[model samples]
Target: MALRAHVGKLRVHQAASEVAVESVSLARRFRGPGAAERGDQLVRAALSVTSNIAEACGRGSVAEFRQFLLYARGSAQEALSQLDIARRLEPPMLTTVIRRLESRSALVIKQLGRLHDNPPRQR
Candidate 1:
């Protein structure tokens, strides 16, 4: 089906950008009047994760890339905290979406750890 194909494309994602897109969508669902502030914070943190990943991978050295990945991982953690705060206001579908994004965040963090622990050999 179409939904499955779209999800397959997401699985081919790079630089954590796909997860950022999901977070932005999740943020939009919080447009109810009082939710703007928390939503803004969440969006910023989520966007930072994507940008950091891109910046990290662009760095000249493995050490530099690892540093940026640490920053991305930190932003991901902040996003998770914000999600916890906003969970009370959201309906269950939004909660499910946030959970998926959170899982992606965890994957990014774990992959970053692996890269740091066993960096790619440069000839």
Candidate 2:
């Protein structure tokens, strides 16, 4: 199959992109001591998830793609962890949003794991 076609079929990539955008918006809500630093970390981790997946899809080999999937999974976990931390630090009003992001991150993690275990066959 063509690389473009394969990439287009990646629903996980779309999920990751959503997570990245949500994370950025959530980070903007952070306002307090050390908020800047924490937001920066969260954004970086969230961005890494999508970035790694994009890189993986562009790779020439299934092994390389799987490797980057592993990286993407790790980044998703990192982003989830940051969201948990934010949940504790932020006000009650933001809890729902943070939880939603957490759920999205979990979905991305599962999708990445599935992809890693059963990568697309190269032709």
Candidate 3:
């Protein structure tokens, strides 16, 4: 796949959007000491999940896009880590949301890995 073609996968956007949504929901549900701080972190990570992908897609080279995907993967891990903290602090309701986000992040990671491992077609 070409860089654009790989990034064009709707699953990427869907996964990111779901993370963003879950972050919002988690933010609302987890309201305790330092909750605001954790919520903000989750939000940034969620945004990074998609923003990095979009930025990579607009880059001139496949290597650049792969770098961005790497960043996005890091962000996903960050978000998941935050979710684990939230689970420890908040009610179980947030657990379900976090799990969903985790699954989505895993899927995105798979896609990113595939894109990176497979060479793009030659012109």
Q: Which candidate number maximizes TM-score?
A: 2
* Runs of candidate 3 exceeding 4 Å displacement: 1-3, 6-8, 119-123
The CA lDDT at 57 in model 1 is: 53
User: By TM-score, highest first, what's the ranking?
Assistant: 2, 3, 1
Off by over 4 Å in 2: 1-5
Best by lDDT: 2
TM-score of 3: 0.84
Tens-digit per-residue lDDT, 1-123, candidate 2: 433326657999999999999999999999889999999999999999988998999988887888989999999999999999999999899999999999999999999999899888777
Q: Write the per-residue lDDT of candidate 3 for residues 35-93, one digit (tens) a residue.
A: 88988998898888888877777676777777877888888788878877877888776
Model 2, residue 36: what's the lDDT? 91
Estimate every model's Cα lDDT from 0 to 1.
0.69, 0.90, 0.75
TM-score of each: 0.76, 0.94, 0.84
lDDT score at residue 72, model 2, on the 0-100 scale = 95
Model 3 lDDT on a 0 to 1 scale: 0.75
Q: Considering only N, C-alpha and C atoms within 3 Å, which residue pairs clash in candidate 1?
A: none
